[model samples]
Target chain A: MRIAFIIIAIVFVALTIAFTILPMGTIALIPVALAFLFSFFAFFKSKERKRIFSKWLMFFVFVLFLVIVAKDVFVKDKVVTDQKFQLEKQNSQQEAQKELEELEGLK
Target chain B: MKKILTIGVFLSFIRICTGQISPNETLIFDGSYELSGMMTNIAQVTMQTSVMKTTNKSYLHLSAEVATFNKWDSFFKIRDLYESYVDPGTLKPSLYKRNVYEGGYTKTEKYSYNPAGNSIKSESKRKNNPVVKNTVSIQPGAVDVITLIYKLRSANLSGLKAGQSIPYIIVFDEKQLRVNLKMLGKEIVSAGNLGKRECYKLSISANTNKLKGADKNLIWLTTDSKHIPCLIKFSIPVGVGQLSLLKTAGI
Candidate 1:
C-alpha cells in the first residue's frame, strides 16, 4: 500500500508539472489535489528513513500549486499582427479584385 | 379542424421576418475554449460587409478574419481569411476565396461561380504544391461558407418548427458539403459585452469528418430585427470551442 501511494503521488506530480508548463495551468489543480492527498498519506505512514523523500515531494507540489495560481492570475493574452501575413492579404485582395472583374465580364 | 386553425394562427402571429446585409456593417467576436469550468481565449474573429464595384456591376463583398491570440501562436497559430462576393439581391455567391494558415501548413482556394452554366471554376493551391484548376457542376443556389453565414442571418427562420432542420449546400475545399441548420427554440443567452439577449438557439451539423458529433454545435442569434449572431459553440477535432460577440457596428 505504501508503494502504491508513492507511485500515484509521482504520477500526479508529473502531470501537474506538465500542465503547469502548458497553457492548461488552470486544469493542473486536479492532479495537484490528488498529489497532495497521496503525498500526505505516504509521508505519515513511511518510516523515518523514507519520510525525508515524502516531505520533499510534498514541498514540490505545494510550490507548483503556488506557481500555477500566480501564472493564471498575472498572465494576459494579447494579439500581434504578422507583417508577412498582412502583406500577403493585401496582394490577395488585389488579385481577387482582378479576378472579380474578369468574372463579371464572363457573367 | 380547430387544431389546424390554431396552428395556422400561431404561425401567422410569429411574424416571420427577414434581414438584409447592410454595407459597412461589422461584427466582432472573441473565440475561447472552456475546460473544467475555466475559459481560455484563443482567437478574435471579425466579420464585415461592404460593396465592391467591378467593371460592369457592383457586388456585395463579405469578409471574415480569424487570428489566434499572440500568446497561443507559439503553440498553434491560425490566420484564416474568407471572402465572398455575392449578388446583393439574391446573396448567391459570384466568387469565394479562402486563404488559411494553421501552424506550419498553408492553403489557398478560389471558386468562381457561373450562373449561366450552373458550375464553379475552382483553383486550389497548397504549400510547396502546384495550383490545380477544375470545373465542378453545382446546383442553382449553391453558396460558399461566408455567404452561407450571411444568408442564414437574412433568412426567415421563424416559420420552422422546433427540431425542424434546413439543409444547405456550401462549397468548401473544392467540394460541396451538405450542412443542416436545425431550430432548437429560443432562450436568453449571455452575449459577451452585450449582456443577456433573447436569442434564437439553433444547432448545426455537417456531413463532414471535421464535425465530430450531432447536435453538439450550436449558434445563438439575437431575436431582434438585426438577428445578429450573439454566441456560437462549435465542436473541433480536439474539443469544443465557443465564440461570443464582443462588439457590433452599423447593425
Candidate 2:
C-alpha cells in the first residue's frame, strides 16, 4: 500500500509539472485537484508513519502547484503579452510604410 | 452656395444609408473541410458564420471546430467562437468577443471600442488567471478579426481592379494589425459541396515575417452581391489547409 501511494504521488507530481510547462492552461487544475483528493484519502486509509509521509508529500505537491501557477501568472504571461504587442506594433508600422510607398509611386 | 451645400449633405446621407447591406438582411454560411498532411486526413474542420440584427444593431457570429478522430473516438479538438457587434451605418464594430478552446487550454477575450476616444478596452482571461485589462489606441473604422471578414464581404469592391489592394486594420489578441487584401482577378474555383463557381480571388497578408509559412493566405469570394467566401487556402508549416464552402443560407 505504501509503495502504491508513493507511485501515485510521483505520477501526479510529474503530470502537474508537465501541464504547468505546457500551454494546457486551466486544465492543470485537474491533476492538482486529484493529488489533493488522493492525499486526503491516503491520510485516512494509512496508519502512523504512512500517514505522516502522506501529509508531507501532500504539502510538497501543493507548494509545487502554487509555484507553477505563480510563474505562469506573474512571469510567463507578461512575457508573452509583451512579445505579442511588439510584433503587432512592428507589423502595423510596416504596413503603414508600404501604404506610403504605394501612394508615392502613384504620385 | 447654401443650396448647393444642402444638396450635398442630403446626397451624402442617402449614400450612407444605402452603402452596405440593409440592416434587416441576415446571412448565414455553413461549411466543412479536411486538413491533410502527407496524403492523409489529419483533422476535420467545421465552420459557420451568422450575420444578423440584434436590437437595432448588426451582429456577426463565427464559430469553428477542428477535430481529429481515431476510428470511433476523438483525439484532439479545437473550438473557436467569435462575436462582434457592428454599427450599421458605419460598419464599425462596437464590441467583440473571442472564446477559444485548443486542446485542453481555454481563453476568452472581450473588446469594447470607444470610438469617441479612438481606443479599445480589452479584457482577456486565459486558463485561471485573473482577467488582464488593457486599453489600446486604434484607427478610425478599425475592426476585429471576425468583424473584418464580414466588413470585407459588405465592402464596395466593385471599383477595385485586378491587382488593386485594400488596406484595413484589425484588432486581434489585444494588438492592432494592418492587413492588405490584394485583388487577384476572377477565377473559377471549386467550393466543395457548393460546387464550382466564379470567384474573385484576394490575397491577404500582414507586414510581419511572423506569418512565415502562412504568408500568402488567399480567399475566393463569390462575384454576386452576397459575396460569400467560396474557398480559403493557406499554407502551414506541415502542409496546406483549405476551407471550402459546403452550404450557405439566408444570404
Candidate 3:
C-alpha cells in the first residue's frame, strides 16, 4: 500500500512539474492536490527510515503549487512585434501587387 | 402575393449562396489552448480587411496575423500570416497566400485564381526547398479559408435549418479541400470582452486529417448583422484550441 501511494505520488509530482513549466495556468493544481494527498498518506504509512523521501516529495509539490500561483498572478501575456515578420509581410504585399497587376483578367 | 413570396425566397437563397462583403473591418481574438483541464492563453490573432485597388479593378483584401505570446514563445513560437484578395462584389477569391513561421518550420503558399477556366495556379515554397508550382481545377465561387470565414458573416443564413450544412471548396497546399460548415442552432455564449452574446453555433469539418474529431471544431458567430465570430473552438492534432473575441473595430 505504501509503495502504491508513493508511485502515484511520484506520477502526480512529475505531472505537476510538466504542467507548471508549460505554464498551463492553474491546471497544475489538479496534480498538486493529488500529489499532496498521496504523498501525505505515504509519509504516514512509511517507516521512519523511508519517511524522508516522502516528506521531500510533499515539499516539492508544495513548492510547485506556490510557483503556479505566483505565475498566474505575475505573468502578463504580450505579443512582441517581430520586425522581420512585418518586413516580410510588406514585401509580400508589394510583390503580390506587382503580380496582380500583371494578371490577365480583373475587370 | 405568391409570386412575390417566391421572389423573396429566391433572393434570400441567392444572398445565402453569394455573401456580401463589408468594405473594411478588423477583429482581434485571444487564442487559447486547453490542456490538463485548464485553458491557457496561447496567442493573439488579428483579422483585418481593406480595399486594394489596382489599375484594372478593386479587390477586397483580407489578412489575418497570428503571434504567440512572449511567455509562450520559448516553448513554441508562432508568427503566421494569411492573406486573400477576393472580388468586392462576390467575395470570390482572386489570390491567396499563407506564410507560416511556427517554431523552426517555415513555409509559404501562393495561389492565383483564373476564374475564366475555373482553375488556380499554386506556388509553394518552404525553407531551404525548391518552389513547387501546380494547377488545380475548382468550381466557381470556390475561395480560400479567410474569404470563406468573411462570407459566413455576410451570408443570409435565415433560410438555413438546423443540421443543414453548406459545402465549400477551399484551396490549400496546392490542392482543393472540401469543407463543410454545418448549422448547429443558436446559443448564448460569453465572448470574453464582448460579454454575453446570442450566437449562431456552427461546426466546421474538412476532408483533411489536420482537424481531428467530428463536432470538435465549433464556431459561435453573433446573430447580429455583423455576424462577428465571437468564439471559435477547433481541435488540432496536439490538443483543443479556442479563440475568444478580445476586441473589434467596424463590427
| iRMSD per prediction, in order | 2.1, 16.4, 2.0
> Model 2: which docking level applies?
incorrect
On lDDT, the stronger of 1 and 2 is 1
Arrange candidates, best TM-score first.
3, 1, 2
Ranking by DockQ: 3, 1, 2
lDDT of 3 by residue, B81-182 (tens): 999987676677878999999998999999988867389889998997999998888887778889889888877666778999988887777767899999
The local lDDT score (0 to 100) that residue B219 gets in candidate 3 is: 93
- Candidate 3 lDDT at B169 equals 84
**Tens-place lDDT digits, model 2, residues A18-101:** 767654545566777777667766776788766887888789778877876775476421111224324643453344334333
Best by lDDT: 3
List ranges where model 2 is wrong by over 4 Å. Answer: A1-107, B1-73, B192-194, B213-215, B236-239
Model 3 / residue B20 / CA error / Å? 6.9
What TM-scores result for chain A when each predicted structure is judged separately against the true chain A? 0.81, 0.60, 0.76
The complex in candidate 1 yields a DockQ of: 0.42
Which lDDT tens digits does candidate 3 get at residues A2-105?
99999999999999898888857788899899999999999999999989999999898899899989998898888998999999999988887876787745
lDDT of 2 at B164: 94
CA shift at A25, candidate 1, in angstroms? 4.2
Candidate 1 lDDT at A56 equals 92
The regions of model 3 sitting more than 4 angstroms off are A1-15, A46-60, A104-107, B1-21
Model 2, B133-198: lDDT tens digits are 999998877788776776787766778899899999888877778899989899998765557888
What is the interface root-mean-square deviation of candidate 1? 2.1
